[model samples]
Target: MPDSVSPPRTIIVTGGAGFIGSALVRHLVAHTAHEVVTLDKLTYAGDERALAEVAAHPRHHFERVDICDGEALRAAFVRREPDAVFHLAAESHVDRSIEAPAEFVQTNIAGTATLLDVIREWIDGPYAAARSDFRLVHVSTDEVYGSLPLESETRFDEGTAYDPHSPYAASKAASDHLVRAWAHTYGLPAILTHSTNNYGPWQYPEKLIPVVVLRALAGESIPVYGEGANVRDWMHVDDHVRALVAVLERGRLGRTYDIGARGELTNLSVVRDICWLLNELVPAGSGGSYERLITFVDDRPGHDLRYATDPGRAERELGWRAEIPWDEGLRATVQWFVDHRAWSVERLRRR
Candidate 1:
């Protein structure tokens, strides 16, 4: 680890109550000196209880506002006078995007535009005179690169051309472009990071890993789309959070970095692994094992076959790399959800 500086004195983290956002908030409060202001609309995907660990901290503040609300975002920006921003708010589910692309466009695109506009104005109007070092770190996904071929050895780099396959990825691609434009056109310092699939504690159960874990624990059929050959590079949320903080502190403005574990596993393999672990940890019924619950389901519309990322730039430039091994991370994640079953059940009931 590099020498640590005193944490950011004041930072704004949009979507700070969500899975990865909450992890980042916990990290900042527990490990650093940053006074964090979490601005979240508290969408179903976001739960304030996730941040209960640091909710009582005098330095931690929460604002209930949507990024799409331009006037509200502007007011928050002015009031907070944030020295840095970690923009993580978005409509992120690919399957949900297929059902309703409009929401994805509105939140990921329009909302990002609104936030950028506010940041641009804030930089030019008030903060310009001070000329302090500031950065806006925009968190995005590797899905914007579309799919990688099953046999391909190459991984997505920061230079990979945009080839979004789903509405969600397309919306994120649009937001990525807007962030870059704000940096280039208006000189607003910004950095973008595209990370592979993240698995860890506090994940919404709708996501694949969590869904599989929960359904298997309940003895429900675990759905596998298509042949379950879709491949995803999995990064633990903690590692990704660390990379995001690194980008905010050290990355060059207007540059994009890719953060991933390079631990690729097929969907079927991942499901089976989870089942096997569950069988050992929480034995199944007398008649069957958790793996027996696997059921093939129709593939999602426009499902990307594979996604992988090369984190070389992030490693070389930011001095960051994924530390947790995949199996260890997966085990920890499964144990977390198992231990927090009530939390997951309550969240699903709310949905």
Candidate 2:
């Protein structure tokens, strides 16, 4: 919401074709005057359709480059001459990470190190004069804190200790440490942000909300894990993108900001709510409802019991706060899936 973002600077957004990355890209194109260069590897989860809204924008450019490629990253730096970088490229799905951890490690940890090295060279070489003004916001997750007891009311904050349980969390934690090291040792100007679960339009169908919505609409069994007791703090993708931009523009160097909307819902409750919304919006059949399709399944290995974060620092310092309430956000998200049911079904089939 700041006025200075309208000055037409080139910014690099890694993984801008993915869910959250695309959301950030759309936000930048719609709200700011900055030219966005989206660097993506076009992985299975990285769909160009997510960036459909800004695909034709003159200020938006897409590069099919993986973050793990140091040479490609260097080339991108030289080609774009970016003023800043927003690192969001990673293997994000926890379930997929459990099945294939090597991919997570390579993309999340190794790729991050490569980007840091490239940025260091940029600052020391071509961008040396503007090094003081350069910033890199490394987007991370709250899963790095591991799980909090379901009965506890406490939430993860900036000072939370790292206790990553799954491969995904561990990979992200390693990336966070590397960012901090680069900042301290090489004096790289960087900001780190940890956020809770994000749900909204254009999210891949493999995720929870989309899975539930698509399943219910298709009259298929909606799967819930482990009695659906795990809790997560949900933040709308729109709110998260706003917080990311705020951090990039106003946050202090070497600081980590936790972003969340305080929208907590258990897995079962979320599923049930979605079913209720679908039953009302799309309707299942005569004398039947979508709630009947709820099906519980075995819990995945190393599943976190609860995850939440206090966004006090982001709200206090960056002048950003989540504006969407849980019900309203959920309603909007469910409605989006319903309206785009064909896209949802196609994505689900591909997965």
Candidate 3:
């Protein structure tokens, strides 16, 4: 394959103010030479400060729009006429999904379908003449494959069957299928990826690592579900962002890639590691150790036992790999949460 260089093109990133979406947006602005548009609903999960650096950059723009809002989505699509659209907007928190499965279905499933409808219309009408190489990168999660036994060595690959166990996973799975159907039925060009758990700076404290760090800092009990035996492969947000870039740049349309770092750890182990790290970073409290705050709670309903991903295809096809080691990434993440404890606390309070 020969490379034909083109002018710097504009791309749209849905949920661009979100944890992973903002990471991707920042990477695109700082590293790549393309114009970036962030389309987000600015929901409770969205934090504009996350993209403070790029928010006003000449190459970046922000759109306060919801994917499920057809008129707004269509209007943005028509105005931007983006060369690529990275769909990362969704209700991602599993607990929130459990509490409000309807919201998950609305945002993750119905929102995706609406997005696809807009994209399909654009591709067939305006986009056909605007650019010859338009792509849709549908970001997904490994949870869609459900769980593997904690004792098993199996990991989800591109071919893994969909066995989503939770409302969140089920919603994402439906969205993934919608993307595929749009590609096959309507001739939409799309690529999908299922990645492992991601952690890093600017992540909302609702997740495990941040929750542990924040709770421990507040001298509150760090709740651990069940025995915290659930296992997950944790990849740094930067690594996941890099993989998304590669997928958008070189991935074949209609192919699904599995992105992960091979950094698997039990939930309890992850919590304990965060506890120990916080102890090293923020030991100014009257407490002896942060681990003492650990509290076991009932397991979540429909919780999967484990999730891991095999990135063989991604590595072989796109030449991308996870660069952040767990130890280095974990320490940095814990340090970030400690440094920004006030911000994390505020987010929790607002929630």
Candidate 4:
């Protein structure tokens, strides 16, 4: 809401077709004057349909290029000459990472390194004149902090130490370290943000909330891990993109910000909330609620007990706050999947 993003700037948004990335792209197109070039490899989790809203916009563009392809990355950087880059490309699922840690390391770690090096060389060689104003906003996950005690009052802050337990988290942590190293050693202008679980429309069905909504509609048993007591802090994707925009504009170089909405709940509670919401929106079975489909399964290997983060630093410094309330956002998300059930179900089937 600060009058326009002021003085239009061209930006490159990596992974712009994925859930959070698409939302950010849409937000930029609709709310700001910045010209956006979406750079995505269109992985299994990415879908161009998510960008339908902005597909024809005059300021919107798309390039099907992989970050790991260094020459292609270099070409794209030279072609776009972007003033800013929001790096959101990564292999981001914990279960998928567990099943194939190599893919995660390759995409999340190697891909990040390739992109960082391209940007570094761009700044040092061809784009040095624009270096003073260029910014690279690297979006990352809070899972990199590992787990916290379920009943504890502690929350990860900006200064929290790295303790990644899963392949996905470890890969992101490594990428974070690389970014810092580039900043320190190569004088890259960059900032990093660690955010909690993000949920909203267009998320891949494999995620918790989408899985619950999609599977319940298919009459499949909804699975929860262990007693379903594991907790997570949820942040609506819209609010997240807004935070990303704020950080791109106002964040300090070489700083890390912890982003969370403070909407903490047990896994079981999130499942139940979705079930009851479905009961109201599109009652699944004979009058009985969808909760009947809930079945607790064995917990994931090395699963963290709980995950939460304190966003005090982001709020205090950026003058940004999560606008959507948790319950309202969750309910809206359930309805969105239900409303788009055909698309959701098809995506799940293919997955």
Q: Which number leads on lDDT?
A: 2
TM-score of each: 0.97, 0.97, 0.97, 0.98
Task: List runs of model 4 lying over 4 Å from the truth.
Answer: 1-3, 285-287
Query: Model 1 TM-score?
Result: 0.97
All models, RMSD in angstroms: 1.3, 1.3, 2.3, 1.1
Candidate 2, residues 209-231: lDDT per residue as tens digits?
99998878777898899999999
Ranking by lDDT: 2, 4, 3, 1
Q: Report the number of the highest-TM-score candidate.
A: 4
Better of 2 and 3 by TM-score: 2
TM-score of 2: 0.97
Candidate 1 positional error at 163, Å: 0.5
Name the 10 consecutive residues with the lowest summed lDDT in model 4: 1-10
lDDT of each residue in 219-338, candidate 3, tens digit only: 899899999999989999999999998888889988999999999899999998988887788883776988998899999888899898999999999989999999899999999988
Error of model 4, residue 272, in angstroms: 0.4
Model 4 error, position 121 (Å): 1.3
Model 2 local distance difference test score: 0.92
lDDT of 3 at 70: 97
